[model samples]
Target: MNSKKSKYHLLVLMDLSKASEAALKNAVHLAKEINGKVEVFHVKSPADVAKYENQFSAMRAIQEDTSNVQSKLMKLIREIEKEEKVVITLQISYGNAKQAIKDKIDSVKPDLVILGKRKNNLMNFLEPDITKFVLKECNANILISGEDNKFHSFDDISLGVYGETIHKEGLEIISDLKTNEEDPIRFFRIRNPNNSDKSVTTEQNKKWAVSYTFSEGENALDGLASYITGTNTQLFCIPRKQNENASWFGLSRINDLIYKLNIPVLILR
Candidate 1:
């Protein structure tokens, strides 16, 4: 509480999953680099218990449930703040998770939204998955932390460039996250053998800091997975849309990669 107000605010979404905890811890790690603070937000649907809200007994039950969750979040926040030497706060609400997150982004206007995700076989069937919803609906930049993320400092970072316009902006965004001026960031240039016209300019390559081409033999997702796993890259930065037309990797490919890759990816909007 005594820490000075943070200029950068990171809003993290916690679903109480193991991934959520990793996201929060990782958010704290990122806060140090960005001079940021963390705000953990959890949302639940009360519709199941709404019918009983009219009943005094059921209303008490709902309130108790909310209170218990609040207590647990507060405890977690306190521990993280104390250990990380950073400030963190929690926000809890009951509603549709995706919509609630969108509302929070609008109201709080955090610089970034950190989301935790695990390998989900049912992601395709799970309508309105958090990653997809945020990518499409929310305007805030997003960092998706996989359950197995180590939350280490971003000593080694990679920016995946799938195309020209959308991806170039990612370089500028990721630069703002680095506290260490000497930190190295190289490009994992995704060669879309299909599109010869789309490529990174000299200026982008310079802004990119360095470059590494994705293996042409490998598919887009495969190359990305290989690079992230093969290198010490702790964080991967890329834009949500691969191109102006939003042709490919717009949602499905990136969403699929999120569940499969156990690394943190910052998807710029």
Candidate 2:
């Protein structure tokens, strides 16, 4: 998918939280940059509607709640359309938040799906992690907006390669974004201590100057986390698909980095 030549259709899951707001802003920024379209989506669960059903007289509480949310979302969409000069769409779904979002993704066929992380997540067993669930199930590319970090551009893009094959599709993703030619990109290739190689490479492409940094560490996720700690990366592009086994670091380790890194992660398929 040539993101630059293609008209991007971005779908953002707006929960009205600060993190979701950031995701919406980022999506709008990207859409304005590439002359794309934005779809702001929200989901309501039946249980939530039932809680407020009695408050309303006759109508299905869910319907009333949906109408109210639709109005607020429309207001937001209009503001964004006027400010960004981009076509914006509003969508609302009812039922389980996860299933509703998955269905929307299938129906919309958006180029990118934007999600936000919860702040101070308490890890309640009852509250399903929508972001993780969607990432695992959805087939489209995803942009997870970290609650602890906010970014407006992908000027400093970082790629973490942990003994895994680098795919051309990943590079295509960068090309599609149409990032600036002067933007700096760092590729960290992590290896174990015994296999460490201090050699570095610099390659100049049509749009970016890619620099390679070799680091030694036993745990791939930990090494990436350490590199992130000492760098000011606006985005992290990782080449891992959904439901596949976490090759280098365990699945739990990947989750740890996603939660702790506190930066936007672009999962490349």
Candidate 3:
């Protein structure tokens, strides 16, 4: 287990929309609690402004609106800072939303990214789905905030392990969390007929309380959620797996769980 103290850093995607406030507030609180820094990103597309110039006025006007939104976001960050110690930075960029976010992630390298789940409607076209893109592309952990404003702790976490590919990364995450006093790590293996050998390998690790369950279907997220619901599990941890073809299965499943579950998720790459 790594003995290093955990330092938290977060990047939050902001658009000045109503759905973002809850996520921003939650991110601020988390930053305060974990003694971390928060970076807020607002992406602006110049092409969009030019394309809709007849509909909407100058690019300067759009820039001014973005600046105003950043100001309001900074004010909220200040409020959180006044009460606790946290470093806040804001960036307004002109480009594609996903590309801008990916660039920022490369430069800033925050531990996690917080995003708001917008309603599924026509407005989704205007409000780009950055979360989905980040999940697929970025190596950083992500937190998708729902309408509920509740904060969850990562203590007493669960790791839903599958194939042998994820074993090393999963153990590393659990070890780090356990070293930080986030104990009682529970491991759940999806039942498989062909993978009886893999199940035997997983059962060898008795350091933490482990449990085995049969998942009738291929959806590991549903099976894990069903097995652990009603328990005091706050966070679900998973590893990022990139295949030889460079496809990521762990991230896809993690994204599914993030939007479907109420609890926060932690993913390690």
Candidate 4:
């Protein structure tokens, strides 16, 4: 845990879309609570301009469009500033959306990158979704906001421990949260439901509130959701495996959990 990097820099990836608004609102509230700065970047693909060159001969039209995006971003900043104590910055780039975002993440070195998980469609297949790409590429932490337009507090956090790798990183991240006496950590473990004869024991030192469930259904998301809804957890923490393809302890469980749970998710890499 790096206590020296207490102050967080939050980058909100936006496109002035409805989903982006929800993400930005949640991010602004979080930034205010953490006393962090907020930056919003809108990405415009240069390929789009090239493809439309026949219809619009002037390159100035594309430049004006980029400028308009920056103006809109500033307006959003002003609106959020009225309600929260955040220093907002705006950026606009013309290139690949994912690459532009990655570049910004590298240059700004933000503590966390906030983004909205958009629906996947055929048109977006080749260009892969930015959120998914960020998960694979960026070294910085990520928070994927859902359609639910609400603010969340990390008063009660749940750690979905399945293996040693996730367990170790989860514990470290939870410790770094600096939870007060009022708030404590909660733990949950998933196992086969049919193994009634088998039992998983939790260490006493790391024990807080522990629950075990047999994942009777094939869907791992259901098992995790049962715990989340049953316990009303605020944040869910999981670890990313070093190997991208292998799933020794079911790393895909995190992806399922992310898609099902509406709350903030922490993926420790």
Candidate 5:
């Protein structure tokens, strides 16, 4: 299934961070490319009632908190929609952050989910392992942006091939967002001590996109990261390793790159 369709529905998670705002802008730019609609989702963590002096104070604070968060979100949505000339909607949720995000994903069933990744801390700029959970479990593909405020232009994409072969399904999904036919996706594989086969891929690979390889005696993930940085890739795409190939590169390695790489990362699921 090439899934070479016309439009898409993109859901962007917004937490009022600089990175998240960037994600929303990038998502808007992407929606323009894919002819997609955008949904800006925000999760307001419940105020700490325990910290309040009494129940009355807690109740008052909670009410104020909701109003502030909602007002800010609405303002943002309106500005982006008006400035970009794109129809966008906003969804706000309460309670647990991770659970709220998961619920939204299930309800929206979007074609793609855009979220932000800040390099300021390691625990989680969003929540505990929320990014990891979504990348591992979500059915739709995820586009993660760093603090870079510049609108992401998916002009030059770098796809990392795990083995001699690449994930065709993932490629098809990414191809749907290729608005510019002038620039083709560049797919590459790193040959090292563990996995090294100089054999060429089939003609089918050529039909999909251009292929490249890098010989690195060092770590494979590091090599892949270097290639993306050197090429000035706007977006980096990697396959979502199913259970069968989970051990190939492990998800933790991807998480470690949160603060390291500033470009948008596409975990093609």
Candidate 6:
């Protein structure tokens, strides 16, 4: 195992929406617990500014507009900094939200990136694409949050394990988290009935807090969804196995559940 001090710097994507607000709060909670700094990021499109240029002075409006948003965020950052003494910074950029974030990820090199799940039903089809884009592009760890996830400590962590071989990377990442000895870590062995491996029983021998369940045929994704919901899992981890079926981590049913889970899904590569 690699040994090094763990230092966390978080970058949270915020558009000032309700869902973004929730994502920011969750990021703050984690930062406070870890004594880490946070960067509140916002992206604007040039076309958006041009659309309103005729009505308002472009330069003045842009500065005033960004300042208004920054002022509110800075106020919140100050309060959190004063109360928890954690450092927080604001970053604003122009262009596509997804691309802007990717660039920021390269420049800032954040340990973890927190993004809000799209809450608009009308744009449901488009939202998952952005999530998939980020998952594929960003190299650092990711935490996807929905509006329902409020500011709370991560007391329970659930690791969705396919079998023994594929989840070793995830275990390594989990070992690095700043977790107390008593914090419960649940290892969920999601078995496929067709496969006779049944590694769950063998895995149980290695850990005390292990749970096993088989995926219901055709309804496997729903079954796992219900499991996460019942567990009220604070942080859910899954492996992003490459060249796998959609069930593994592709842009399909599992992707759908990733957005619907309402909790942070930490993708482990």
Highest TM-score model number: 1
TM-score order, best first, reads 1, 5, 6, 2, 4, 3
Better of 2 and 3 by TM-score: 2
Writing each residue's lDDT as its tens digit, candidate 2 over 136-250 gives 7888778777665354764334443322333565555566564555654555545444653543322235234344444434555565676765676666666663212244444
lDDT of 1 by residue, 1-269 (tens): 44776767899888666667878898888777666888888887776445674678777767888898888888888888888777788878887777787899999998888877665531221234556778778887888875574665643344443334434445455655543445445555555466554444434334544456643343667766777677756666666655432555557766666665666777777
Poorly placed runs, candidate 3 (over 4 Å) = 1-6, 32-34, 47-57, 118-128, 154-183, 197-205, 216-221, 242-252
Q: Write the per-residue lDDT of candidate 4 for residues 176-268, one digit (tens) a residue.
A: 453452443454445444444433332324344454444435665576677776776666655564332134235355566677776666666
For residues 128-236, could you state the per-residue lDDT of candidate 5 as single tens digits? Answer: 6777778767787788875667877654344434434446656555665554545645665654445535553423435545566666444656766676677666666
Q: Please, what is the TM-score per model?
A: 0.82, 0.77, 0.73, 0.76, 0.81, 0.78
Residue 223 shift from truth in candidate 2, angstroms: 4.3
Q: For candidate 1, what is the TM-score?
A: 0.82
What are the per-residue Cα lDDT tens digits for candidate 3 across 2-33? 22444667788877665565567667766555
- Shift in Å, residue 198, candidate 1: 5.8
C-alpha lDDT of candidate 5 relative to the true structure: 0.67
The true-versus-predicted C-alpha distance at residue 10 of model 4, in Å, is 1.4
Instruction: Give the distance in Å from residue 232's predicted Cα in candidate 1 to where it truly belongs.
Output: 2.8
Q: Regarding lDDT, does 1 or 6 come out ahead?
A: 1
Model 2: pairs clashing at backbone N, Cα or C within 3 Å: none
Q: Output the lDDT of residue 79, model 4.
A: 79
